[model samples]
Target: MSGETIYKGNKKILGLTTLSFFLTFVVWFNMAPFTSTIKEALNLSKEEIGVLMSINIALTIPARIIIGMLVDRFGPRKVYSSLLIVMSIPCFIFAFGTSFMQLFIARAFLGIIGAGFVIGIRMVSEWFPAKQVGLAEGIYGGWGNFGSAAAAFTLPTIALFIGGENGWRYAIALSGLLCLIYGFVYYRSVQDTPSGKVYERPKRNGAMEVTSYKSMAGLIFMTLPLYGILGLLTWKLSNTSLINSSLANTIYVILAVIYLYNVYKIWNVNKEHLKEGVDKKEQYSFRQVAILDFAYLITFGSELAVVSMLPMFFEETFELNIAQAGMVAASFAFMNLVARPGGGWLSDKFGRKKTLMILLLCLSVAYMGMSQINSSWPLVLAIILTMTCSFFVQAGEGSVFAMVPLVKKRLTGQVAGMVGAYGNVGGVLFLTVLSFVNPSLFFMTIGVAALLCFIASLFLKEPDTAEHSSIVVQDKAGKEAAM
Candidate 1:
């Protein structure tokens, strides 16, 4: 197909996939708007409310990894639809659950829906060529991510319109129902790829395949932080009284065993390929994946952490009312609509490595500047700094994923999963840091992390794509290739 024809035909599929992802996020974060209502209804303590907030993201880290593998195995069409339909069960349960345990269990399961982001990464890469995939993926990511903001803005008023003690419950359940119906619509509306195209499948499935034993070791080393972050979350649960100390200790031991078992699985999957060595044409550095992991940890990860705390930061630092503070803090997330896609377009115009390096360096500097904000600073200036810092942070995220699918076409799901999980790891760790320090130190810590990521980006090798086509086509050129 010609490039113009391809763009026209595939535009519909892109819209459908982005809409599916947007609805999933709408359900994933539906709980946030009703926090106050839920707290009042349940007569819960502040600590319990905090635990519920934390629970919403607890399952997402591992879910992304598992979902990534599933996307590669079953294709995004089936996986995305299935996830949407199945997660509705938990969404409805959280909406109407009466007890703390009920709400906790429901919210934890609902976290799996956050993995919807990875499925679309593979789907969009299939529809768009390598040259256009960055901006395409950026649109998928940026617009779909707006579901959270949409939920924040709309759900509360929706509940108010419905009116009554059950108003919030009904509002949330309505979103669940809509998402559930859209799951089937999405399944019928979209295919895995364009007509006559064969979807690429990885030869090995259970664990990620690494070409070299050195990369294999790096993969194992990187896996530790996923489990470590989970452990940190467990400790947070214990402190919040959501679980007893005994139960928390038991869970930690189980997590350790799971980590070791996972190590064995990684070895089992890659040992054969590593021992004999792979074909020269097929080999790619695993270090690229590792660097992107840290890159996302600081970028998207800090974005999550900051979004949660920024409202409070504004309220306290500038002595603004809750509404004013929320509006000002919202400038950070609001940047997603443009900044993320702009980052990807920059990567497409310039080189991917150069764009990512520049974004991370600016991100580091922006955060360092943010660390110096205080009551003495003008409120308008602080808001400007916040939005400016946010642009680099989100743009850095777009740049990271711009290279994820380029790593290994078949392993894109798993690669995206690992990199995406580290984003959450950054969130859990950074939030833990916030628990002990003030806002200034929190910003400084993230500044330092972004600087470290900037250093690591120096080692990222640009994908050698001299042999590939620069435009969309149907044959081998259609395969997800590096740039």
Candidate 2:
């Protein structure tokens, strides 16, 4: 298809997919806006509340990987629709949950919805060509990611409008209802690919395929950290007395076994390719994926941690009321609407590698400036600084995914999934650092991490659009046909 024709055809698909992703995030984070209400109503301890919060994100790491595989095999339209519809069940359960255990189980199940972001990565890549993909993905990500902030801003008013002690429950349920309805709407509205274009699938389903022995080894090494992060989470729960020692030990063993199983799958998936070696045209470096993973780890990860803490930081540092503090903290998230898209536009207009390197450098500098904020600083100046830092952080995220779809066309889902998971890993790691340190120190830690990512990003090779097609097409015989 011509660029103009493809652009016109994909407008509807982009709108629907972005909306679907927004709703999924709303449902996924529904509990956050009502945490205080739920705690008081259920008479939960602080530790229990902490556990509930942690559970909301715990499953998402592995879910992204599994959902990536599903999307690649079944197509994003079917898998995403199914995910939205099925996840609403848990949302409803959590909305009406009367006990801690019920809420725990529901939140854990709802974590899968967080994987919805991965679906749109593959979907947007399929629809847009390399020349335009960065901007398209930036729009999808920046706009869709605004859902969490939307939930935070709107759900409170929604609860007040319902006007009862159980109003929070109703507000939460409304998000689920929207999700259920949108599932059908999305399934009817979008196609997996443009007309006459074939959707490529990976040769194996269980694991990502690698091109060479070294790439295979790198893949395995990277996979280990995911399981390790889960282990760290379990250890934290045990240390807090959230789980018994025996249970924690059991979970650790299970995680180890799963890691071994994943290693085996990685070997199985790439063994033949390692022996025969893939064609130069077909092979892309796993190192590219790794660098993106680290890049996202700092960009999106710090975004998550900062958003969670910024409200309190503002309140304590500036002596502002809860309302004022929350408003200021929100500016960080609200930047997604423009900042993320701007990053993508820059990536498309300039070079991807240069855009990312510059953004990462600015990200580090922004955080370093943030680390110096204190009560002495003017409130307006602080807010401005916060928003400035947020721009680079989110734009860095835009730049990272802008290149993700270009890595390996068929494995785009899995690659996006792993990189997306590392973003969460960064969130967990940074937040954990916050638990033990002061706010200023926490910000500095993030700044330092961004600096390291910037250094690593120097090695990123820009995508050669002249040499590689943005989309991969296959013939009926399972051979690469066109791009």
Whole-model lDDT values for every prediction: 0.88, 0.90
RMSD of 1: 2.5
lDDT of 2 by residue, 375-459 (tens): 9999899988999999999899999989998898888899999999999998999999999999999999999988998999888
Taking the tens digit of each residue's C-alpha lDDT, what string does model 1 give over 379-446?
Answer: 88998899999999988888887888888877889999989888988988899999999999999999
TM-score of each: 0.96, 0.97
Error of 1 at 411 (Å): 0.7
lDDT of 1 at 284: 83
RMSD of each candidate relative to the true structure? 2.5, 1.8
After the best TM-score superposition of candidate 2, give how far the Cα of residue 227 lies from its true spot, in angstroms: 1.0
Q: Model 2: residues >4 Å from true position, as ranges?
A: 470-483
In TM-score terms, candidate 2 sits at 0.97
